[model samples]
Target: MIWTLFLALFFLETESSLTQSAAIVPQDPTLTIGSSIRVTCSVKPELNLKAENLYWTLNGRRVPSKFYTVLNSTALNLTLNNLNGSKQQSGDNLLCHSTDGRILAGTCLYVGLPPGKPVDIICWSRNTKDLTCKWTPGSEGETFLRTKYTLKYKLRWYGRDKECQEDHTADPYSCYIPKDLALFTPYEIWVEVSNRLGTASSDIITLDILDVVTTDPPSDVHLSRVGELEDQLIVRWSSPPALKDFLFQAKYQIRYRVEDSTEWKVVDDVGNQTSCRLAGLKPGTVYFVQVRCNPVGIYGSKKAGIWSDWSNPTAASTPRSVSERIAGVCDPKSGEQNSTFRRELKQFFGWVKKHAYGCSGLSIKLYDQWRVWLQKSHKTRNQVLQGDKS
Candidate 1:
């Protein structure tokens, strides 16, 4: 029994010794950028090692001998100056090695900036069901360390402060609260960031869920030509389906662009109308249109609701110019040349007067070309008539 007890004690001592490090001073230190530090490695007396035979490595790379200071026969010192931020959030690997390249002692060097005050904490709800918030990092925004960001919120009057679970892998500065949000009650929200160096909290914001609610994009956007009008197309869309049951008045915006172009022209005067006439479009050209909605006084809240995302693009084309249609109608192959020309000129003037409310420069240019052609056609007709009489 005594021998067994001795064996157990021997194993325990060995395990304890293995758990202890080789006595590196300033173990696992945290530091700011541009700060210097002095680290020391001490050898156990039983190891029979000399400090002079010791060397150091930082992040697996050998440190130059100029930074080494041999304090005694069993200790060695390394001084680093003007340290930069750590290469990783876990910290920089610093190891002391023997001359023959055996690891004697090791520690991590955490060199980075502290967390700054989180700024621009903005929160919005989806149909007043849940809340989501995002914030901008203070200053340069890169902490270079493993910083923790916590989003805390509560009812403005009285409630337990709760943390919003942050999905750092998805978005480091954003958090989503899925359900159980109050509608009319105001919420106090803020973000707090922390690291080993320091901590800072953002300015708290108070808002009701109804005040910041946003709905899905407007749906079923349809576009069509405005009845023989060359420069106009009619766009129609249904209000956001999610908010149809809610008590709110929606203001819509329409933006369109020519199919071949990337620049968009926005129409903001489309009050609450689901159908709007887009004018001043290029004739006989395809256009893409999109619409968005802003709910005003949602649930009788005084503040305007957030704007929904732009709807999917819908495409339509305007009709060709009146002159083009007239030319098509008065085909020379179907009728006598003199009679066809006369019919085209008569239709052109009447159609332009009826259709061209806001005539574009292209329409005026077409009219000028048609006038010159008409004068030449009349001269030719007179010549033909004279020849027949002769």
Candidate 2:
């Protein structure tokens, strides 16, 4: 019985020794790039580890002995300075190895660059139903890791800070706020950016819904000639679909460029009209035109709101180039006195055929009576008076 008990104790000790392995202190550390770090590997006392037999490997390569110190026979310390983001983020494995080429223990090191503060934050709402905010990233925008941006906002008076879920904006740095908007209430908005390294926030921007109600870009922009004029074209477009039902006066702006030219000329005095006559354009030249709208007096607002995005461009050409005399009209356009007289006569006859107000009948009756009187008089009174004076 004593022999059997000693044998059982011996088996237990062997099993424990076989199971022993090196372990890392502060396993799997995460740190900022360029920061210094230290780690230790330790084994059970029974393993009889030696300082000369232990070594370190980083990313499948052996680490120099100058970077480590032997704390004791079973414990080895490794130090790394000036960690880089790319190397650490790629799951750099730091392993404690024995001289016999057996990996005892290992841990992954994660080094990253922190996000910088965001800048140039701008927010706008569409018809007061939704708000969108965009921003430029802080210094060194690229952090090697995927960065997350969240837009947070709250009413200035009372409300819990809320995260914006709809961030599918055209600008990558933008977020959408969809609900719980008040026209009169001012809102405080900001963006928070985070990554594995660290997090940063933008400065808070406060604004009212009405003051920033910029509508979508204008659509279905149409272009046509103004009457028969050669140098003029009329540009027309409808209000944004979201703001059409809202009571607001929209002022339009027009810019045009020749097909061959890269510069654009802006027409700033379009006022609140949906259609404006563009005069002084080159005749017979294809031109590209764009229009944008600024909504004013929205919901009886005394101040003007922001301008909407420019409409998708549209193209139009002026009347065929005309002789300098006619200022770009169709060729053979009435330029002479006879042509003008014929045009007037055609207009007169058109009036007679249309709404003459019985004036056509009156003119026909007077024409026959005047003919009969002139024939019966035999000579004019003015002619006889001139003959006697001679």
Candidate 3:
């Protein structure tokens, strides 16, 4: 009976040891890139084991022999030196196993890249209230290569003895010029781009702020069917009344597009002349037209000045045949009446210009008046044509 009891006791002790071996647990699972982490394998009863046989593997691949060391027989620690927080190395499973073959534990690690670059840096003069520096998106990093950018800016005022003022940072590259910059003076601006590897600089851009002056819109905008076969349209208008003779150097920009289309084609090179022609238009199609001015000085040595607000949109349709329309209206007896009508029309325009506060309603009223005149003129010409036919 004693022998039977001994066998049962030995069997119970074996089962307890097995249960304890299975209870070994691993350390925490998360680790950041470029950081160190310690992993431990714990068992219930510490086994006085040697360090040489402790093994570590990441994702089933053995870590290099020199990268880590085994602590006591029951504990193993790893120091991932200079860890590059790359996605490929992040969240990978790391396993530590002992030669006793009974203790094993694993942990998962995570790595992350740096932050994105800053945006929308605007430079304005404190003195002139003019925007001196404006920039769009700069260069970024490659997908295979983790990358970021830094921005820097420099501002220099003419005739000032001080050196250029600059603002920037290695990370989140952006700068803004305050509103207190001197007004009515010229300033030069520059921007730079940088990354973890190197940097690039932009060419200097210069701008001038003029003393604020009262300005008015352009006047006498007229559109007429000009070309014969191709059915082109010609637009003409006088310069803004507020423009002094010295500002006559201003160049005009004409923008036009078909009424049915949303795209706006620009003629940036319209010279000092007040007229511009748009060709290659579809015959019998209605078109909308507008104009703006860019005041350039010094024969392009300086950048063009700020653009004026766009003129009121005027519309004109190409006639199918100019000769037929003119013949219907030509009458020697009606010449006196036509002259009187032209005089009245000029007076009406003058009154509108004087009283109109440049409001949208005023523009609509002008367009409506022109439309009424056109309808009346067409009816009169039709009556003359009918009389000639009879």
Candidate 4:
């Protein structure tokens, strides 16, 4: 019984394959957009089907009967005009169905335009190591078909063309070369995009690995309050450590924003300085600061390196104004006490600027310093009065 069941399955599979092979004529024809074609469906004499009994459907929707033509008793023709591009990348399915709505035969129609030329090719290296390149697709970039993108490069003066193994996790139009990049020699890079329609190439861009190099963001970014300056903060950062061995002069940029604001104020005049003084800020407010670096003239090459990513944000707050504190804390009715308090407060902050560490100019030591200054100021005032009387 088992043997008989296996034989029955084999016969069914064979009949299915034969039925598909003998049905659709010009099976799976790829035509260009706006083109027209006449596809024929022929039924086997044994199926006892008539030409008028067969209907057509495309992508599971019924085709209009007006487009059908009766060729013979066992054959029918479908005339499609002014075809558009396939709705899917896998091409559109056209099927011939029997009177019972059973699918008899099927084919795929490929309709699309050739890819346009790739443009705006750019390449850069990270730490003079593996290179990466990206390009913009030409025209609409949508061919409505399966398309392939390849990044090709070679040493400009020597060596053969090699395909850049694409990193799938990267952007769809970008590729990465992890290692084995030449430093001094110029390299030519371009991209080629292709599909069933046609292929296109981008303009070749030639660059040296050393010239197009970038580095990691500036490290060890520290932001602090400027000494006794209510409206300024000082931002300092270390250079990108990886590029120190290379011959390059790196420039820096600093940007900062208040704690409650998303708008950033950028300082562009920092030049090559590792430290910059940000002025004209709201006092008593915390600010977030970040820095980035650009290496210029690397390896004596004239081309400027790409800017590194901005460093992680570092936070610090400008010192509160002495008047602001006095307005909130001092007793308004006591004129003498208020005067004496303001004087001691000024002296305390001045001393904090000179000697305080890690207190943001408002240390617990401030009260002790205020007491000492009060005692000294009274003695000095008395001595001056005695001198005046004498």
**Could you give candidate 1's per-residue lDDT for residues 137-196 as a string of tens digits?**
878578788899999999999988999984556889999999988888899999998999
Candidate 4's residue-wise lDDT over 341-383, tens digit each? 6876787767666666567556434654554454456557768
Highest-TM-score candidate? 4
* Clashing residue pairs found in predicted model 3: 91-109, 126-179, 126-180, 126-181, 127-181, 127-182, 127-183, 128-183, 151-173
lDDT of each candidate versus the true structure: 0.83, 0.77, 0.56, 0.82
- Per residue, candidate 2 scores C-alpha lDDT tens digits across 1-390 of 999999888866543332267788878777777898999989776677785679999888999999988898888888999987756345678888878877888888877778999998888878778888889988887676667888888899897899989877566699887887888878889889998778999999988888778777777899887544556788998878878776347777889899999998999788877787777677687888999878777776666678887888899887654343234444453567478657646755565555455663656434333323433343365467669999
**Collision pairs in model 4:** none
lDDT for residue 185 in candidate 1, whole number 0-100:
87
Per-residue lDDT of model 3, residues 120-163, tens digit only? 44443322332334455443333112233323322454244332
TM-score to true structure, per model: 0.77, 0.65, 0.40, 0.78
Off by more than 4 A, model 1: 1-21, 45-48, 166-168, 321-390
Give model 2's TM-score versus the native structure: 0.65
RMSD of each: 10.1, 15.4, 15.7, 8.8
What range of 10 consecutive residues in model 2 has the weakest lDDT sum? 367-376
lDDT of 3 at 260: 88
Q: What is the lDDT of residue 270 in candidate 3?
A: 87
Error of model 2, residue 355, in angstroms? 28
